[model samples]
Structure formats: structure tokens, C-alpha cells
Target: MPQNKQIHLDNRPTGEAELSNFKLVVGETPALADDQVLVRHHYLSLDPYMRGRMNDSKSYAASQPLGQTFQGGTVGEVVESRHPKFAVGDKVVGFGGWQEYGVVDANQPGVLRKVDTTHVPLSHYLGAVGMPGVTAWYGLVKIIAPKAGETLVVTAASGAVGSAFGALAKARGCRVVGIAGGPDKCKYVTDELGFDACIDYRQHPDVKSMSAALKEACPDGIDGYFENVGGYILDAVLLRLNAFARIALCGMIAGYDGQPLPIQNPTLLLINRVKLEGFIVSEHMEVWPEALKELGTLVATGKLRPRESIAEGIEKAPEAFLGLLKGKNFGKQLVKLV
Candidate 1:
């Protein structure tokens, strides 16, 4: 029997995630069943959506039960396997939670994908060339379908999905304006990601004034809105949407810790003839290969930059997740385990 380090939900967070909310412990690694594999986790992904899982409420997936390890995306190597597709020393990615060793059932949705890491960093399978990249591509091309010369706006522009959205839109000859939290993120969005303009939401407190600034940046009005933070900024964008505008509803990190604040400008959606649609990446796996392939080329050619903020050790997993929620991470937040 092997002892593994795991983080479990000690208590539900009241607002911002606290370090005490997670319990780190050493537990016995379970024996693998027939047709199962024992995976040793290398890296754990800390995504915003995981915040929703911390709460005991109805969602796409159930919240983590108290005393159970929190669920997440992980990249690891197979140590033992009863499955033919996976063998010892196979490098793969899966939903292995925040743990050092995982006994993965081969048939589950979070099963690992074996890959060759010689061409790219293994961490990327959790970021730009993986879920976030695929989510951005699917949301933009499939949902919004922006035309050339149209204006596209994305909030949380420095994040993995936001940067991907901006880069893809710019590639298609659409004008891109990004709304980021601060001056640093604003600079990164406009200078590094090649967006036409960026608005620092923190510097500008008034949404009405920010809306004016956005209108100045986009004189023709926004044709597509890629919403990552849904709150006042969303309400402001609503007032400036062009007729027949499309909104690709992604994660709402602004209200993730609490109940959603009522939008004051939802009527603007009807007044501007805007269409709003929400999406999850699971429904678009068929298009993932194409997105990853194209994103890989861009990354290899240095056209697209994938930024990662990594925390070392499985003990630091909870801190990394909390940082991601507080917008402390510059890009994708990941934890490196044994």
C-alpha cells in the first residue's frame, strides 16, 4: 500500500476561498480494480469553475462532499494499469483531483489521454493547447461567428480563455477590445495579444464612463461580446451592443463566490436585438482537435503566447486555487505535484 497526499473539502467557503477550507492529509492509495490504472499525478489545474464545485448547490456537476478530495484536471504518468490502452510509464492527462497518486477507473469521463510530450510542455495539455483553448475557439467561432471587420470585445482579457479569444478574433480580421482588471493586464492584452485596445476596469470605477471609453475605442459598437466576468461590465457592454450583436456567455467569475447581482441593463439586450447564449466545453469536444492543432502551430511559431503561473507541491494546490479566484494568477494557475 502507498501513502498519497490529498486535499479534501474541510468546509464550504463563505466568500473568498480560505486556506483553512481545504484539509491536506496523507491517505492510503487504494488498490486498482480490474481494468483500472494507478496514476501518479504530476500537475493539477486550478480553474475558476472549480469554485462552483465548492458550494453545496445544483450545478452541471455535484459539489465536493465534505471530507472528499476536490475534483480537478490533472496531468500524470501511469504507474500501474490493467487496461490495454494505458501501460506503465504512459504520460496522460485526466480529472485526477488534488492528489499525489490517483486510482483512475478507465471508463470514467475524467480518464487520461496519452500523449507525447517531446514537442510541447506537458503542462500545456491543461491550458492553451487544451481545455481553455478549446473553450475559447468553440465559444467564438461556433457561438458568436464574428465576421471580418466586425468588432469583438472580451472581458478578463489576460486569462487563458480571454487571450485565446482575442488572438483568434484578430486572426480573422476582427477588431478586438479587451477589458482587463488592471494596467498590467491591460498592457498585456493590447501589446502582447494584439488587441486593438484594452480598458483597465479597476482604474475606471464608473461603468457608465467605462462604457463611454469602450464606445470611443469601438466607434462602430461591438458585434460580439465574449463574457468571462459577468456583472457591471456586462451591463455596460449591453448598453453599447450593436443591433444583431451576439454574446458568448462563458464563466462568470465576478459572481462565483456569491449569489448573482441582478443586472440593471438586461433590457438593453432586447432593445439592441442582441442574442445571448451560454455554453460549456464538454458539448464541443468534436471541434477540440482542430482548435488545439491550430493553437499549437501558433504557439510553436511564437504567434500565440501561453502564460502559466505555477505553484510547487500538492500542499500548495489550495493556495493556487484561491489565488485564481482572487485574480492573483496572471494566466492559467497550476500546481506541480510529485
Candidate 2:
């Protein structure tokens, strides 16, 4: 029998998640029952939203149970199957958690689906052409709803979702500006991702400084904003918002470390008549098909390029995840489990 390696949640983190909060165990793989398929994970996606699930407080999703396998999205291949829909060697993507192998029931809805990796890379499914890509689509197409000649500002611009949003917005004829942490990411956002401009938020440590920089970059004001890293970035963007602007509130990574960072200028929302709304991507699954189609095409055609920060083994998942929360990893953070 093959040994299956799994990481479990050992403790609820009070602040930043540490290695001690997780426990790894190796065990014999269970036998497959009827309509079951055994998948060996090739890559595991580490995302910012997983941080919210670690807390015991109420969230969009249920709190992860202690001792249970830590939840994550995985791209894998079927190694064995008793199900008619899946066959051996088929590539698949699913919520397989932090495990080397996953047993998926064929009858279950929204669990597993075979993916074609011929045109696009298998790992891309976990990032640009997958959930993160769909997340960018939902926020841009559905919420912000930018028109041609408008200005769109995205926070965490070099990240998977933010990069996709910038590329997609630019493709639609919008002037794109990205706010990232450093010079390198800002360069990638403009040079590689083709944004109109990028602001290095590290240089401007305070809201006042950032707002000045934002004011210069967005001379016409921000018509739409895709917020990823909130706190002061949101404050800075709020000050630059055009009348009746739309803001798609995504992950607030700044406040994820147990700090309650409130917006200093909530009045801007009312004064600017900004349509500010927070959204959880999983809650809106109806757009997945359409979003994936466009994202996949853009990626396959070299239009929507997404970068990756890959860690080599399943054992490195905890470290990679911790690094992601701290913005230590660039682009999409993934663990190569195969």
C-alpha cells in the first residue's frame, strides 16, 4: 500500500500561523470504494483566504476543525479509479486539502473535474486559469464593471488575482495602475503585465504619502478599484476615487494578522458615492464557467501571464503558506507535491 502524507491543523492561530500550528502524518492509503477515484496531487495552491478559515471566529466559510486536514486547492492526476467518469492518468483539480492523495467520490457535486493540461500548464489551474483567475473576473467584470477610457487601480498588483485583473482590465481598454510592495513587483506589473503605471507602496509608508503618489499616477482619478491588501492602501485609494466610483473589496491581507485595521476615511464612501462591496469568490460560482473560459484563453495566448512562487515538496507547504501571508512569496504560491 502507498503511504499518504497529510498535514492537519493542530491549533487555531491567534496571530500569524506558525509551523507549530500544523502536524504532518504519514499513513497507508485507504482502499477505493465504488464510484471512487484516487488522486495523487501534483501541486497544492496556498492562498490568502486560507488564513480566515484558520480563525475560530465567524467567517464566510466555516472555521477549520483542529486535527482535520488543512483545506486547499490541489491539481493532481488520477492514479486509480473505480469511477466511470475518471480514468487512470487523468489530470484533475479539486479541494483536496493538504494531502498527497485524495479520494474523490464521482457522484459528489463541485468536488472533482478532469482538466486538460495540454495547452495550459497543470499548476496554472491553481492560479490564473483557476479560482484566483475567476476571482479577478468576478471582481472586475461583475462588480467594478469598468468601461473603456476609465482608470482601474489594483492593490497587490503582482499577485495572482491582482495581476490577472490588471491584464484583463488592460485588455478591455482601461488604463490600469497597480500598487505593489516593492520596485521589482511594480516593474513586473508595468513591464510584464502591461499596466499603465505602478506605485511602489513601500516607498510611501503612510496614507498621506501614498495618496500623493496615487494622485500623481491617477491624474484622472480612480474610476474602479480592486482592493486586495486593504488598510492604508484602501485609504489612499479612497482619497483618489472619482464620483460614483466602484470598489470591489477582496482580501484584506493587512488586517489578517489579528490586527483590526479600520479605514480612517469611511466618509469618502458616502461623499464619493462609491459602490464599495466585500465579496467572497466561492459564494459566486455562477460565473466560473465564463470566467475560466476567458482566463484560459488569455493565458494560452500569452496575454494573461501569471507568475508563480513554487516550493518543492509537500513538507515545505507550511513554510510556503506562512511566507505567503507575509507577502514574502511573489505571484501565486504553490507547493509541488508530485
Candidate 3:
């Protein structure tokens, strides 16, 4: 029997997650039953949404049970299978958690699916062509519904979802502006990703200053906004919103640490008539096939460029996730479990 190394949630985090909250253990892989497949993970996705799962309170998804393997998306290859649908050597992507291997049931709907690595890389599926890409697509194409010649702004501009959102908006002939944490990220957002402008949020001391910078970047005012990091960034964007603008509320990393980070300008939504809506990507699986097809083509053709910040091993996942919450990562954060 092969020993499987796994990382489990040792304790629920009250504030920011600490390294002590997780534990690594080695276990034996069980014999495959009928309609089962054993997968050895190659890449594990470390996303901000996983932080919410660490809390004991109710959320869109269930709280990760203590002493269980931390839940996450994984891209891997089938090592063994008793299922008729899957065979050995099959490459798959699924919610396999933070482990070296996963035994997945083939009967579960939307749990496991094979991926083609011929056009796009395997790791790219976890970033650009997977959840993040579909997230960008949903917010941009479905929610924001931006028209050509409009101005669109996205927060966390250098991140996986935000970068893809900006690129997709630019492709639609919209002038896209990104708001990132630092000068380096701002430069990459504008120069590399081809955003019309990028505002370094760190350069501004307050929302007033940040709003002015946003006004300058978006001369026509923001017609569509893809919100990722909320709080002050949300307030700043609200202050500059054009009438009848659309806002896609994707994430709020500011309050992920169990802090009380409420929106300061709720009145803007009424005054500006902004269509602000929050969404969980998993709930909107209907449009995934359409979104993935477009995203995959863009990635394979080099039209869409999504970056990654990779950690070497499974043991490094906790630290990588912590770095992600603090904006230390450049793009999509991934753990190379292989």
C-alpha cells in the first residue's frame, strides 16, 4: 500500500490563519471499490475562498470539519481505477483537497472530469481555464455586460480572476483599468496585461486620494466594475461610478480574516443606480461550458496571459495561502504536490 501524505485542518482559525492550525499526516490508500478512482495530485490550487471555509460559522460552503483534509481544487492523474468511466493514466481536475492523492467516486456529479493537456498545460486548468477563468467570464460577460468603448475597473488586478477579467474586457473593446496593491503589480497590469491604466492602491493614503486617482485613470467614469478586494476599494469605486453602472461583487479579501470591514458608501448604490450583486462561482455552473471554451481558447492562443505563483510542496500550502491573503502573491497561487 502506498502512503498518502495529507494536510488537515487541525483547528478553526479565529482571525488570520496560522501555520499551527494545520497538520500533516501520512496514511495508507484504501483499496478501490466499484465506481472509484485513485488520483495522485500534481497541482493543488490555493485560493482566497478556502479561507472562508476555515471559519466555524456558516458560509456559502460548509465549514471544513476539523481533523479532515483541507478542501481545495486539484489537478491530477489517475493512478488506479475500478470505475468504468475512468482508467489509469487519465488526467483529471476535481475538488480533491490538500493531499498527495484522492480517492474519488465516479457517481458524484460535477466532482471529477478528465482534462486535455494537448492545447493548454495541466496546471493552467487550475488557474486560467478552470474556476478563476470561469469566474472572470461570469462577472464580465453575464453580470457586468460591458459594451465596447466603456470603461471597466477590476480590483486585485494582478490576480488570476482579475487579470483574466481585465484581458477579457479589453478583448471586447472596452478600456480596462486595474487597481493593484503595488507599483510592480500596477506596471504588470498596464504594460503586460494591456490594461489602459492601473492604479497602485498603496500609493494613496485614503479613499479620497484613491478616488481621485481612479477618476484620473477612468476619465469617462467607471461603467462596469469587477470588485475583488472590497472595503476602501469598494468605497473608492462607488465614489466614481457612472449612472446605471454595473458592479460584480466577486470577493472581499479585506474581511476574510474575520474582521468587520463593511462598505462605507452603501448610498452610492441607490444614487448611482448601480447593479451590485455578489456571487459564488460554484452556484452558477450552468454557464461553465461556454465560459471554459472561450477561456481555454484564449489561453491556448496566447491571447489571454494568466500568471502563477507556485509553492514547491504540500507542506508549503499553508504558508502560500497565508501569503495570498496578504497580497504577497503575484497571480494564481498553487501548490506543486507532485
Candidate 4:
């Protein structure tokens, strides 16, 4: 049996997640049974949603089990296969977790999928053309339902989902604005991602100041919103919404560390007659094929040119993930396991 390096959840976090909560382990790879395939992960995705799962609380998804490989998305190549649908050397994407390798039952539908990496990089499958891209599509197309010439704003604009959201919105002829943490990220959102404007939230830390920034950037009033960070950002956006504006509440990352961040004035939703909906993209798998189709085209045709921030090895995943939660990573936060 081959030895495998894995990161496991040693303990659940009480308040904020710390490095002590995780432990790296060296273990022997389990033998594959019938209809199983073994994959050697090349890149591992680190996302904010995983933070919520670390709390061992009642959430939309189950908590990450202690003593198991930390759950994560991976893009890799099959190294061994006992399943007829998969073959050795086939590139694939799956929920392979935080490990150098993973095993999947090929008979289980959607657990594993083969991807073509001719035009797109294999790492992109875990980001822009994968879950994050589909997430942006669902929020903007299904929830916000944007109209051309209208103003649309997305927070975390330099991150995976936000960058993809900008591209999708631009393709639709909507005026897109982004709100990122720092000046560099804000600049990338506008200059590289092609967003109409990007506000630096760090400069305007309060709702009043952020609202003023939005007022100047979005003089026409916001027609739609895609929120990733909650707290003051959401509060500020509510003040700038036009009547009947729609909001796609994708992620409230501000509260992911087990903090209480109540929306200051939820009544604004009523006053503006806004349509705000919170969603998990996985729940709406029906839209994946359609969303991935468009996202693939954007990446293949140079429309969605996303950048990435990759850590060197599996041992560095914890540090990379911690940095990601604090908005330290520029674009997609990935760990290069190979």
C-alpha cells in the first residue's frame, strides 16, 4: 500500500478557528474495491464555506468529521482504476478532501467527473469553471436576474466567485461594480476584471462611509446586489438599493468565524421592496450544466481571465486556508498537492 499524507480535523473550534483545530497525518492508502478509482490530487481548493463546517453547529451542511481527511474540492489525475468509466491518466474533478490522494466509487453519480484540460488549466476546474463559477451564475442569473444597462454590485470582487460574477454580468451588458478589501484588489476588480467601479471597503469601514462610496460609484442606484461578505457591507448596500432591487445572498463570510453580525436594518428590505434570497449552489444542481457551459466558454475564449494564489505543498494548506478566510489571497486560494 502507498503512504498518504492527510490533514484531519483534530478538534472543533469554539470561537474562531485556529491551527490547533487541525492535525496532519501520515497513513497508508486504503485498497480500492470493485468500481473504485484512486486519484492523486494536483490542486486542492480552500474556500470560506469550509469554515462554517468546522464549527460543529447546526448549519445548512453537516460538520466536518473529526479524524477524517478535511473535506475539500480537488482536481487531479487518476493513478489507478478498477472502474470501467475511468482509466489511469484521466484528469478529473471531485470532492477529494485534504490529502495527497483520494478514492472514489465511480458508480456513485456526480462523485467523480472527467474533465478536458486542453484549453483550461486543470486547477481552474476547482474554481472559475467549476463550483465558484456556477455559484456566481446561480446568484446573478437565477436570483438577481439582472437586466442590461442596470447596475450590479458584488462583494469579494477579487475572489473566485466575485471575479466570475463580474465576467458573467459584463457579458450580459450590465454595469458591474465590485467591493473588495484592499486598494490592490479593488484595482484588479476594475482594471483586470472589467468591473465598472470598485470600492475599497478598508477605506470606508463603517456603513455610512461605505454608503457614501457606493453613492458616488453607483449614481444611478443599485439595481441588483450579490453579497459574499455581510455586516456593514450589506447594511451599506441596502441604503443604495433602488426600488424592487434584487439581492443574491451567496455568502456571509464575516460571520463564518462564529461571530454575531446581524444585518443592522433588515427593514430596508421592506422599504425598498427588495427581493433577497440566500442559497447554496449545490442544492440547485439542475443549473450546473448550463452554467458550466457559459463559464467554460468565458475561460476558453479569454473572457473570464481569473488569477490564482497557490500554496506550495499539502503541509501548507492550513496556512493557506487561514489566509483565505481573512481575504489575504488575491484570487482563487489553492494548495498545490503534487
Candidate 5:
């Protein structure tokens, strides 16, 4: 039998999670059963949604139990396979938890996507060309369906999904406005990603002022909103939406920190007949391949750039994850595990 180190949920968090909330334990790696492949985890993807999983509360996914290994998506190399579909040395992406080695059932959902690194970097498959890529593509092109002349607003605009939304909206010929925390990130959204404008939300005093800033940048009114942080930003965007406007609610990062949900601009929605739709990328799995293919082409052509906030080693995952919740990461947060 082999051995591995795994990180488990130590206790349910009260508010913000600290390193004490997780426990790192070394144990014997479980033997693979039929149709299972053992993998050596190379990278673990730390996302904001995982924060919801730490508490014993109702959510889109079940809350993880105490002492159980906290689950997450990992990119790994197959070390052994009892299944015929996978062989040793195959590079694949799947849910491997936060461990040095683990067994994965081939039939499980979110199973490995075989990676070909000849065309792109392996880590990117976990990021831009992966789930985040698919989320941006489908959320914008399919969900919002912004037209060339439309104005699009994206919240948390410096992060991976938000950045993708802004950049892809720009590529589709929409006037894109990004809302980021600071000047550097705001500049990155405008100067690097080619957004029409960017609003530094941290500097703005209130949602009304942010709304006014958005209005200044988009005199035509926002036709589409690619929302990442919900709370007040959503409220601000709601007040500025044009007639027949579309909003793709990607992730509510602001509300994730235990803030109360803000009320919507009901009168505007009623008058404008705006369309606001919320989605999880997993629900629309059928559209992922086509979206990834399109996004991959964009990356190959230099039209898109994927940003990553990489923290080395599995032990740093908890810290990295906490940083993500605090909006410390600039892009996709990843843990490089060896």
C-alpha cells in the first residue's frame, strides 16, 4: 500500500476560516478498486465556492463533514490504474481533493480531461482553458448573448472568471467595463485586457457613486452585466441596466463573506423588462466542450490571456484559499502540489 498526506476539515468555521479550521494528516493511501485510477496530484484548484462547503449549512453542494478530507479539483498524473481507460503516466484533470495521492473513480462526474500540453501549458487546462474558461464562454456568449454595440459590466473584474468575461465581451465587440479593487487591477483590466473602462470599487464611497461611475463610462446604459461579486455591485448594475438588458450571475463573491443579500431594483426590472439569470456551469455541461474549443482558439491566437495566482505546495492551500476569499489573488487561485 502507498501513503499520502491529506487535508481534512477540522471543524465548521464560524465566519472567516483560519489555518486551524483544517488538519493535515499523513496516512496510507487507499487501494484502488476496479474502474479506479490512482493519481499523484500536481495541482489543486482553490476556488471561492469551496468556502461554502466548509460550514454545515445548506447550499448548492453538501457541506463537508468534520474530519473528512475537503474535496476539490486537481490536475494529476496517473501513477497506477486498475481501469483500462487510463494508464500510468497519463496526465489528466479531475477531483483529487487536497492530497499528495488519491484514487479517483473513472465514472465519476468532473472526471479527468486528458491534457495535451504541446499547444498550451498544463496548469492552464485547470484555469483559462478549463472550468473558468467554460464559465466565461457560456456565461457571456450563451447566457447574456451581448451584441457588438452593447455595453457590458463585469464585477471582480481582475479575477479569472471576471477577466475572461470582460475580455471575451470585448472580443465580441461590446464596450466592456471592469470593476476591480485597486488602481493596478483596474489598469490591468483596461490597458492589458482592452476593456473600454474600469471602475475601482474600493475607492468609490457607495454603490450609488459606483453606479454613477459606471454610468459615466457607459453613457448608453449597460446592456449586459457579467456579475461575479453580487451584493452592492449587483445593486449598482441593477440600477443602470438598459431596456431588455441581460445579467449573467456568475458568482456572488461579496455575499460569500456572510453579508446580507441586497434588494434588487425591482422598479427598473419591471420597467426595463431586464433578464437576470443565475447558473452553475455544471448544470450546462453539454455546452462546455464547444465553449472550451472556442476559448482555446482565442488563447492560441493571442486574443485572450489567462491569469493565475499560483501558491506552491498542498500545505499552502488553506492560506491560498483564505487569500482568495479576501480578494488577494489577482486571478485563478491554484496550489501546485508535488
Candidate 6:
């Protein structure tokens, strides 16, 4: 067995997260007990949702435990297995957290999952074809169900969830418009991701400016919205929504660090007759198979080409993750542990 390096939460962040909140330590992957499987993680996913988990506050999920490996997702290969269902060298995805190695009890169902990397890249299991992809599917299909020819808008448009939502919505023959921060991301959303239009929110700092931009981009008015970034962006989107627009509230990255984000004129929801629903995709177990199959097919067929920004090692995870929270990473944020 080798020394396993892991990052643990030492304290909860009071405002914005700082490096001091997490401590990196060297530990060992203990010998596998009966029915235990050991996986050597190749990649660690860094997502905005994990930032919310870092705080000891009431949320959709419990706060990530202190002194434990930071909770997130990982894709790797099983190096040892004592269980009948898993074998050595099988590619797997699991909630491996911020560690080089993860041990799971195979007796627990859904603790780890075998993945096929023949068509989809192994790292993508943490992004486009995995939880992020499934999240986009559930939000768009189950919540904001858009009809063909209707206009739909998504914020954080070049990130994992937003990218998947764009591809999925486009396939349904809807006009997909994306909102991102800069020229590069906005370009990728329209050029690579095939969105009908992309709005650069950086060019429009205030809700008034943002609404003007949305008006030009979505002249038909937004019929559905995939809300990844809530704040002024949500306020701006509200102004352009047509009557009876649907909103799938997936993330509120702007307020993840205990910042207050009061949506101005929330009465817009009433006036628009909008169906706004906040969702945690893990709670919807029934949609996984259907979502994964569609996302995997989109990736395999090259219709949904997702991009990634990967840091080199586990030591860089914290910095990379902080960059993710600030929208510095270009695409799906990840750390290559191996």
C-alpha cells in the first residue's frame, strides 16, 4: 500500500472560502476488509456545489463533515477488490472526495459504479456523461420542459451542466441562448456548443444592462430558463421571460459563500406564471438511466463535445476549485491525481 494524500476540511468558511479552511495531509489506504473495494483515483471533480457543502449551514444537503476528505466526485480504476461484483482494474466512478485513493464497502449498493470508457473518455464520467450531465437532463426535461421553436436561456453556459443543457435543448429543436462571463466562453457556447446566441454578462454588469442584452439575444422572449447562476443574472432573465416560462433552479453560485442574493421584483414569477423549481439531482434516482443513456449517446456520437480545465495534481485541487467558484476555469474543472 502507498501513502494516500488527502485534503480535509479543517474549518467552515465564514464568507468566501480560503485555503486555510482546508488542510492537506498524508494518510494510508488501509488494507481492504471483507467485501471492501479499493480504487486509485485518476481524477477529482471540482464543482461549485461543493462550496455550499463546505459551509456548516442549512442547505439541500448536509454540510461536508469536518476532518473527512472533502466531498465531491472521482473517476478512477479499482486496484483491489474483495467483493464478487467488482474486479481489479475495473474503471469506476464514485464519491471518492479529495483523495488519491478511496475505499468503499462493496456490500453497499451504489457505493461505486463500473464505467465504460470505450466511447466516452474516463474523465468525462465526472462531467458530461455523469452527475453534471444528469443534472442538466433532469432540469431541462423534468422541470423546464421546453417545446420546439421556443426560446430557452441558460446561465454558466460553458460549464459542464450548462453545456449539457445546451446540447439537450438544441436536440429538441428549441432556440438555445447562453449567458457566460467573457468573449471566449460566450464564443464557445455559440460556436462549439451550437447555441443560437450567447450573451456576455461581463458587458452588462447591472440587471438593467443585462435585460437589454437578453432582449436582443432572445427577441422571441425566454420560454424556459436553466438557472445555474442566480443573482442579477436571474433578475435579468426574469425581465425577458415570456408568459408561463419555466425555470429550473439548479445552482446559485453567486450566493454560495453566504452572500445575500435577493432577487429584485420576484413578483416577475407571478406575472409570468413561471414554474420555478429548485432541484438536487441525486434525489431523482429514476432519471439516471434515461439521462445517462442520452448523454452518453450525445458524447459518443460527437453531438455534445464537452471541454475541461484540469489541474495537474491533488495538491492543486484547492486552487483549481477556488478558480472554479470565480468562473476562472474554462469548462468542467478537474484535478488529475495520477
lDDT of 2 by residue, 181-213 (tens): 888999999989999999998899899999999
Candidate maximizing lDDT: 4
TM-score, one value per model:
0.95, 0.99, 0.98, 0.99, 0.95, 0.99
Structural RMSD, model 3: 1.0
lDDT per residue for candidate 3 within 254-290, as digits (tens), equals: 8888887788879999999989888888899999999
Candidate 4 lDDT, tens digit per residue, 109-222? 899999999999999999999999999999999999988999999999999999999999999999999999898998889888899999999999999999999999999999
Model 5 TM-score, all chains together: 0.95
State residue 330's C-alpha deviation in candidate 1, in Å: 0.4
Comparing 1 and 2 on TM-score, the stronger one: 2
Runs of candidate 6 with Cα error greater than 4 angstroms are none
Task: Please give, for residues 102-216, the per-residue lDDT of candidate 5 as tens digits.
Answer: 7888877567767777777777777778788788888898879988899988887888787777767878888988899899888888887788899999888588898889889
- Candidate 2 to truth, TM: 0.99
Q: Per-residue lDDT of 1-338 in model 1, one digit per residue for the tens?
A: 57999999999999777999999989898888887999888889999998988888787667888998888889989999988888899999888888999988887754678867877678888887788988889989998999999999998888888888888888899999998888888898888888999998887667788888888989999999999888888888888899999999988888888777678878888888888999999777789779988777766777778788899998888888888887889878899876
> Which segments of candidate 1 are over 4 A away from where they belong?
108-110
lDDT of 4: 0.94
TM-score of 4: 0.99
Q: Model 4: clashing residue pairs?
A: none
Greater TM-score among 5 and 6 belongs to 6
Q: In model 4, where is the ten-residue run with the lowest total lDDT?
A: 12-21
